[model samples]
Target: MRRVLTALLLTSLLPLIAQAQSYSHTPPGHTGLGGMIGNPSGLSLKVYGTDPASFTAYDFLLAYDLDRFFFFSLHGLYERPLPDSPLNYFLGPGALLGVREGSSHANEMVLGLSANLGINFFTERFEVFLQVTPRLHLIPETEGDIGGGIGLRYYFGSQ
Candidate 1:
């Protein structure tokens, strides 16, 4: 009986998946702008590779650390589309530079290396994404930590 129910559920969803229309979220050479909310959350920008067939991208971000400090990051990412869905997964490594604020700690710069993993949901002209990043501090000290955020981007080109 359990097997029959499982099969029925899958069968019902198969037609929906097959009939779905998918639009490319970020085609090559297109740029996206948006913002995020979470650890070091702020303005976000991304540009897909210039090659039409390439799945690579560049990401730039300016974010704040919960009112404590501001940071900037630039990453090289590769996006993979999930078959039969309007979802994409991306991962990459990047560098981060942050400046502390408030009190004598202000104006201190910290450098780190970051690895990011994220998923994106594409609509006709907008993309929503959530990402988690692990950072390893190298300068000013050595420490490892993880952070994540939710963000949305608007595409400014053809789908």
Candidate 2:
């Protein structure tokens, strides 16, 4: 009776162990902290077609990928993404707290809201994406405009 019971227990545990080993080789989900570096470029204009201007800039972003395609980012953006593909795109609404250094106006705190849309490609350790974002600057009294750039993202966690 002891021998039979021991054999049954081992047999029951084998499937569970094999399942764990199989999943161990697969990559985990995108729900963790990650960092992105990219260039940003787009059009800027005041509300109601006031003071329309265009600028090119660079940006660095720190964000969390909520899933395979969705992300929430806190980015220091300088340019916007290009508008070509609409299905595979990147876009989000975020606030900007920074200065426009080279403008004719004095350097001051600028508050802005932005939305981006782009596509993402993922590898084992990194992700590359392109997106376009439009921003509205409130404090500096600049018109809201569209911007986007190519971005590279690196993931740090278990594979």
* Among all candidates shown, the one with the greatest TM-score: 1
Show pairs that collide, candidate 1. none
Task: List per-prediction Cα lDDT, in the order shown.
Answer: 0.78, 0.41
| lDDT, candidate 2, at 13 | 44
Per residue, candidate 1 scores C-alpha lDDT tens digits across 97-120 of 988674766577789999889988
Cα lDDT of candidate 1 equals 0.78
Against the hidden true structure, what lDDT does model 2 obtain? 0.41
Instruction: List ranges where model 1 is wrong by over 4 Å.
Output: 1-25, 52-55
lDDT of 2 by residue, 1-159 (tens): 533653575466445433432211113232222333222322221111112252121233433221111222243322232354211333345666555543454555556777655555444544444566666767767777554554444455566
Which window of 10 residues has the lowest lDDT sum in candidate 2? Answer: 42-51
